[model samples]
Target: MVLQQRREPYPHWEYTDPSGAEVLRVVPERGGLVTGWSSLGRDWLYFDAERFADPDLSVRGGIPVLFPICGGLPDGRLPLPQGVFTLAQHGFARDRAWELSALEGGDGVRLTLAHDPHTLAAFPFLFRLSLEYRLAPGQLGITAQVANAGEDPMPFSFGLHPYWAVDDLSAVRLEGLPAEGFDHHTMAPATLAAQLEALGEGVDLLAHPAGPVRLRGVAGGAAVTLEPDAPLDLVVLWTDPPRPMVCLEPWTAPRGALISGDRRLLVDPGGCCSLSCRYRVDRGWG
Candidate 1:
């Protein structure tokens, strides 16, 4: 299994197993995004080729890295000891480019990004972020590490937003979530039973205990399993009506953590923290 470099619409790395049972592509130039993953020639990731072509538009699909802050801030402003800084939804890491640091055998690749002057102006912290993507026979593992390089402690949140390909949003069912969660739009109370019963257009839950979340009843008799190393504080379930895709997000904190201070990660100076999650596909599920 050798890693192949390709230059087309953008620069990317591709890996294919010897048996041709799996293939994965990563775009280091686009925030180290995993653009595609396929098993048995079946794509498991939802990506918009048109949106990806536009350099200005943030790619709507794939696994987008959410760091420093997982969701939106109150009024898009973060209050710090120094002052108030304007931070956008999901932070700035996804909008910036990440450097490809390592390629492990044919199964893994590592990308790293650090704070620069532009990042400091908004985040006011010195930190290094590393993301590693590894592929197995039937699983894809994502590991993220954030190192605080500043003298002061760093406050942040992190998450992964993956758009999964589904045949029908109405036919999907998610299990292993907490009995209750919170709504993203209204911040209203929500429950696992109600979500399953209603199957609403969109829903968001916060602070779920760490465990394996499973999605079953996908089109073509497939299923997806997500297992995180630690319990995530937030879980987001959303999809657009009439679209054959849904996003199951895992977050360290809920939206507006910068103001609520709820589940925010505080890394001490010279210290680091890490989190990881694995996605497995079951092709024979019925």
Candidate 2:
């Protein structure tokens, strides 16, 4: 799928699978929406908000989660990183335009975004983000491949922010996680020894009777459940003040800055970090 840009403002590009079965519109001004996923009946699922209303979450949908490189510099009160001059929020991957590299596969579409000297100045690493949005028989697979093209090893964290629609948050029951791993984002590692133990046997989210998970209309509202394979260590469920969407973020990094304070990575100009996951939705009875 290739979109011809005409310098128009709202929608910068558009993508359609070979059969034209699914279409995604990229709007620079409106936050890219996987606008049409008929395979799943257009039930809003996926997250990237233009602006995170909660002071807690700084990233919105379709935004490349970046770091050295975490959301808006600590406390919205610091100069840009040394040797950097770009005006992007956290990293340059999200703000800069992404080119559609390829979409001719058996499953879905693949998009690529790369960084150069200019982007390195901000995040200090030569990297390529290849995002693949693949739609298979009954699931939507999302994969992010981060390759380090710089000479030095890079140390960073990453995650995905997808907003899914739900009937209500309170009525939704999240399964497959520890009942007590809900510590404050700022909790120190040392202070969590006890708390971590208190969280009885980790919840096995992948054990739903149907197979992995089950998202149904609970108590008159909708619910979402993710039964991810082993690598996804944390799952964050979020919803804005009055929005109808819920964000089920699977992360390799926490929301805030790294507390242990260690930043060292060796890329040798060709290292990479890749994360992949998928979600299947079966909206029960509208």
State which candidate has the highest TM-score.
Answer: 1
Candidate 2, residues 7-102, lDDT tens digits: the string is 432334555555655545454322222433444335345344335333255444432344333343444332323442333344445445555544
Question: What is candidate 1's CA lDDT for residue 269?
Answer: 96
Where is the poorest 10-residue window by lDDT in model 2?
A: 202-211
Count of clashing pairs, candidate 1:
2
Model 2 regions more than 4 Å off:
1-14, 18-21, 27-36, 46-90, 183-232, 256-268
TM-scores, all candidates, are 0.91, 0.67
Worst 10 residues of 1 by lDDT: 198-207
RMSD of each: 2.1, 7.3
**Residue 71 CA error for candidate 2 (Å)?**
4.7
- Give candidate 1's error at residue 140 in angstroms: 0.9
TM-score of candidate 2 to 2 decimals: 0.67
